[model samples]
Target: MAQALGAQTIYEIKQALHRCPVQLSRLVIHKTQDYALELVDYKVLVRLNPLCKALYLLFLQHPEGIVLKEMSLYKTELWNIYLQVCRHNDLKSAEKSVAELCNPLSNSIHEKIARIKSSFETLTDKHIAEYYIIAGARGKAKKIALPPNLIVWQ
Candidate 1:
């Protein structure tokens, strides 16, 4: 099936379909050589409305707990789709569309983090340490003064 629909042909089809503003399809096919998918089998998978909605909800509920690596992977995949969209449309328009789709979720995730911070007073130290880890910091660990009511998890 893949051989019958070559990557270039698939990409061209996606470009044409994308140009039709009324079309509802979310799938975007691109040349495999253009982007690398770390996991999942496909060059690009522009999730449909339902899956995207579900993911947004999950992200809202567990923003800090979500794995950063997985989010990075998903962003990379989406960026590839943005590149494909740009091929058929103007680059600025495609970038704006992708940003419009992604920015809200990004803001929501940040808001969730802020909510978590506000809910726990003594969590400041632990949360800061976690931020360092997420930022890929290296060096000796800094001592954190935890309040008596605060609980630290190893």
Candidate 2:
């Protein structure tokens, strides 16, 4: 009866718009109104503190990866980024924090990156979180596994 009333309206099927395939590995870190890391496919949002977020942003800007042992070389650049995003005007304290972040001590940056990775891991599963983390071989430079094209600055 419905088909007779209107052929166009007769039982039809359509794909779900929401089900369109998303790049499961694609990730974005929002630095505009909020500080959060997102997994496009899974719609996962991981909010990060200003310090951690700044550190993560530094990695995003360096595609070739930065050597953990040579972090001191990036002190000025890292500090600049931190000052811009840390949401505070206290140069004295921000300077000190940046110093510690780029410190020569092997454990300093290692521990910080680990914390950021662990934070994301807690937001979703460890496997997905790994893609958002700074990872590399023992002696190789460390970088976020995400491709540059996939990153969204804002």
Candidate 3:
């Protein structure tokens, strides 16, 4: 009977769906007063240094955009986040680190940004990684191009 055939087809469709290896997992950033960023997908937790974490979070906060020339302006705010994640008892010793971050002439900030990009790539493909990177065209403002919907802010 057609009813029996339809029931068989339904069972087959359920089996097919169950056999397909597809599971969706979201990327989440766990927040803490310590100011560290823990990038978590289903299987990986990417860890970053305090300075790198601070810079990455700063960009994430600003979806609009930020340029290299403007890196100096974020120094105070960057330090505030960095200080919380830094493993130092005194802020004096960490002053040099913040100084370098604020220096427009320094490439250290660029290096940190690259590390953040690579960290994501290491966990996923370039396609997924690209979503999380600070992307911008030439002569344009760079941004942490991830969609606001994809990011779970904690």
TM-score of each: 0.22, 0.75, 0.75
Distance (Å) between predicted and true CA of 124, model 2? 2.3
For candidate 2, what is the TM-score? 0.75
Clash totals for all candidate models: 0, 0, 0
Residue pair clashes in candidate 1: none
Cα lDDT of model 3 by residue, 75-95, tens digit = 888888777667777778687
Off by over 4 Å in 1: 1-74, 105-154
* Clashing pairs for predicted structure model 3, backbone only: none
Which candidate do you rate higher for TM-score, 1 or 3?
3
Cα error of candidate 2 at position 102, Å: 0.9
